[model samples]
Target: MPTALKLTTVQGNSLPIPGVESWHVTAKDPAMLVMTDFHWHSSVTVSENSTIDAALDHMKHTGVRCAFVIDGKMSAVVGMITAYDISGEKPVQHMRLTSTPRNEILVKDIMQKMADWHVANLKDIESATVAEVLKVFTDSDVTHIPVMEKNANNEQRLRGLLSFAKVKRLLVA
Candidate 1:
């Protein structure tokens, strides 16, 4: 039978790891790695009330794959529309070909709700090693994860985004 081992965090917090010794000391932990800094791409935000057509135009202008849906001070990720989502069916072509204006289709009509999507906060992500993060990307259906920073008031604010492609590059490097 394989022997189990216990791991601890930098603060001597015990972590559960089966059949592994000093698991916290492994390369998977960010604390053990030399690279502590993580980079993020600028966030593309849109109002939940905005039309899908408008959102698409904004996405094209920004050249980003996803956009966060915001409503006043209460911001939550509504849904993410990727190039593939807009492509394949060629909605743009159909819109242009038809007389229907783009503004008619609201983002709420198309955006996936927060409850329906897989989301992770910075604190939840910070504990993960690069390999672990990569695993999340591979295992999950989502391609992008929004990174949030806690403000002085203890409110989570969307700071930036982490892309699976970028994480993959870092891992390979």
Candidate 2:
């Protein structure tokens, strides 16, 4: 026979939560300044078939400048869309080329395909400084870039994203 264990009454109604500490970051600091680690955060995503306006609206609502494009079942990332891609000349170019109205243009029409995306290895990013990552943003002339890592199966997967806008916000101007 097992003996009954004593239970203690709850002391407080509130539970402790993780605290966010603000830090002054320099270029020489860790590249965590701009990284949106998916391990700890959710990635904003949209469907490829969604309208450009819809995608832009979602991004705006989420206060994000970019979103990952997902497949039909929302299973995998198929591409990426940025506020610039929707608001820039790409929309107009697509409208003129395909004779499709602006409203009819879909995210897939303007989003950069995943296969064409330039990515950084997670290992490199792990040891990189803010300035080094910033150099990549400058050299690539891109506001965002995905960081990739290999799984136990040896297949590449998205680990996180680095955003120049985030970097500017965290580092001293």
Q: Across residues 1-173, which tens digit of lDDT does each residue of candidate 2 receive?
A: 89899898978897666555565578999886568999888999999999999999999999899899998887999999999989999999999999999999999999999987988888888889999987888888688899899999999999899988878778874
lDDT at 160, model 2:
95
Residue 171's C-alpha lDDT in candidate 1?
A: 54
Give lDDT tens digits, candidate 1, residues 1-173.
88799896576667668734432233365621312223433567787777776777888898766777776455555556554545434456556666555557556655656666565666766676777767777888767765666889998666556666555544533
What would you estimate as the lDDT of candidate 1? 0.61
Against the unseen true structure, what C-alpha lDDT does each candidate score? 0.61, 0.89
Residue pairs in candidate 1 whose N, alpha carbon or C atoms collide under 3 angstroms: none
Quick one: best TM-score, which candidate? 2
Residues forming the 10-long window of minimal summed lDDT in candidate 2: 15-24
- TM-scores for every predicted model: 0.55, 0.86
Runs off by more than 4 Å, candidate 2: 1-23
